[model samples]
Target chain A: MSYRIEELLITTLAPMLEGLEHVAVGAASPIPGAAALLARHRGGGRPRVSMLASRRHASFTDGARELFDCAAQGRIDAFFLGGGQIDGSANINLVGIDGYPASRVRFPGSFGSAFMYFVVPRVILFSLEHSRRVMVPRVDFVSAPGTSPSNVYRPGGPYALVTSRCVFRFDRDRGRFALASVHPGQTLEDIREQTGFDFDVPARIEQTPAPGAQDLVLIRGPVGKDISETYPDFARRVLELDAATA
Target chain B: MTNLETLVEAIHDGASVALAPDYSGCAMAAVRALVRRGARDLRLIAVPQAGFQADMLIGAGCVGSVEAAAITLGEYGFAPRFTDAVKNGRITLRDSTCPAIHAGLQAAEKGVPFMPLRGILGSDLLTHRDDWKVIENPFSPDDAIVALPAIRPDVALFHAASADRHGNVWIGVRRELMLMAHAAHRTLVTVETVVDDDLLADEARAAGTIPALYVSAIAEVREGAWPIGLAGRYPADAAHLAEYARLARTAAGFERYLDEHVRGRASAA
Candidate 1:
């Protein structure tokens, strides 16, 4: 029994690591960044891990405001994003990109996701917290398309959806995604029950791996106190979801 | 102990400082006052390296440009061309800028790890820095890390709405002033009116912000946000901005304006 965040990072994201040529990570995306960096370190140059603000932090070499243009045009290899609002179609809206009333939801505004989604062949999404409010049937807006390849997305759309509960895969043709597998100890019915919309849950799901002690140390070290500071709401979510980012 | 007179005397005699948010608050006025008192040599730092106050400093020959393309802002935000401002004029843009970088000295003085960032990597800025180094994460052998060096200034300057005889100050609404006082090696707090000490203390009490220990000096002066844009506090005087825009189009033009306004004026007196 390992911490949920540790498991999600080490087992789920770690094993998924293939030899991506170059990957772009966006805002609130320290998990994938850490995961990729960890994998390449543990797995040996698996992929060139990068971030949307790589230049800002000092580790990134290719600093482009528009990830889709460069990624679609073969500037980068993969991208990672999160959806505050996702629908059955896999389309996501971080928050309403449309004019906000200033009363309700306040997301930090979309940062070039449209172009990135339409271009990158490999897209991985991780939800810091998963809930019915997050995994909805339809997004409030479309920052990036989730399903494509039918000329709708000339290149591709989201390849995988990593949630707190389960991992999802999309049909390359139909564009509707199905449950790739539920995490270890979780049932397809469990995932279905928690989701906001009806979805095709496969009978088979895999158990996610927990991060080892060494992995946990690495995961928590670079983050410093900034993790809890940045995600103050994590205390509430951690108790509710019974998950940990290690 | 350096009182207001000694500190203002030092600033008047040419001290380098960074002016946060509103044209270093009243450092310009303090500098002018110093000039009237026969003190000289004042340099200051402003963000958006190409803006009007920045131009005026260059015009007055007080500051040339930011020492490095990047200075920390406690909580203000980032300027996209920060790296480009020093790097061969090639600016790569980013997306998240939080307007806190203008409060760099504040965080240093306040003793914080990292302030929030607004815009940095969401633009073409990233493309320009392929030559920049990317290294393995220091703690995580498997992860990567980017090295951001520390930023420290020689002197800090800012203005507040009011100050007491003891040099305790209060700036309404704007927190950028507090940030400047904290970050500089030598600091100056200039104000329009010398108010009651309790009133300034009450203002800080309301905000629950930094104490006066962070500020090194204070001088009473008016029109502190002059020749600089201060939204809602004072008018920016767009005509002045446009005029500065013309003079600051190049380094040579900026130098001439500084010579005429700053050096020439000093020579005349």
Candidate 2:
């Protein structure tokens, strides 16, 4: 069965959420949001998925602070983060480029990444754009560090980084990212050329597996229907599911 | 009955105002009124994050500075006016993380000087915010955490579904509004309707109601959170927002948007 990149991304990310008690997807994250929904659907609703801005999915009654409070209390098992610039050490910069305050370029400032990256046990780093511009040797500003010092009271850190081209697993102890697998049709040289930072590659590199036929059915059917409430444009464009029809 | 203008007039220039994110309740009508009145040099305290409301305020040139975790039009893409203002040195940006902002307001709510939170030790947000301090955890030796100062805005402004004649505002599940009402010196609200029934008289509604004590004033403005709608009451006007996102990309376009939707409508009203 033919699959879109969105389908591939959802299938690839859904398994990472396996056995997680609760997975939260932040704002403007359509792909991860769909993946979480898929994971929940597959798990028979085992992992409670919380997608911010969606009333149906989110169970936070104590308002915006509840998510943070829940994370701080170590209730959230997995979360997703993205960056304007990400370094080899997994330091993600959601703040702007250049100096402090007066930035030459300003991406939207860090939302909950600073706190969530530390509190959530598994933080899957995601950025669709995988070029030197985004994957920098060093981030201009550290919105959230990939890893913290021993005494920082941090239980969570970077787990893996999923990009358009490949996936890289973060070694928290070493403070570096090692290539996990390349997406189908993307070569090792392509990833190496595009990446700004250096990473370790195992002797045998594997291709990222494609979504199964059943995975595509779930994604196009119920998962697409669920995500449309919050991210309509993404569902319509990618899954070809209209809000009315879905 | 209080008028929208009168409620907005209380907000003087240079006043620090607290605003909720788009997903929560937002007073877009009052924001347009502020722009209509040419309010200036305002300091915006976004509870944690902001979107269309903040962008519109910044684009209207009402804001002098913004302190928040983020200001972006989710799904619609980057908040154009905010991005332009930051890059062109039009406004001072005090960057913060989500929990820190919440913590700061929580400190204000508790009448405390500061509140300590975990994480953000290595983030550059620490370097910029002079008020934020990092100290050793007293109880746990050698452990470090960041302390954020209290965020007490002069006024907390938002739109809600309904208000009682007695000034109690029914916010439903958006309890951050209650927090803002508690933390701010004055809480100004614009509601869709002012019901004759006493909100506090009922047990179910009372749970979500912000009492008159915390609410300084309220005016009824139906569909007050237009373009960015109130949850359960209405879904966001995505087409309008997409149009806004498109037009707000350029300075001329933004001004045109202001003229057509904001400035022109204020005069018509």
Candidate whose TM-score is highest:
2
List runs of model 2 lying over 4 Å from the truth: B267-269
| Docking quality category of candidate 1 according to DockQ thresholds | incorrect
> What tens digits encode model 1's per-residue C-alpha lDDT throughout A134-214?
888767656556653332324645677888777887666776778876666677667877788766665655665555777
lDDT of 2 by residue, A1-246 (tens): 999988899999999998889999888889999999999999999699988868788789888999999999999999999999999999999989987676788888899999999999999999999999999999999999998878888999999999999999999999999999999999999999999999999999989999999999999999999999888889899999999887
lDDT for each of the candidates?
A: 0.50, 0.92
Query: Where is the poorest 10-residue window by lDDT in model 1 chain B?
Result: B89-98
- Tell me what fraction of the real C-alpha contacts between chains A and B each candidate also makes: 0.00, 0.87
Instruction: Give i-RMS (Å) per prediction.
Output: 15.7, 0.9
Steric collisions counted per model: 44, 0
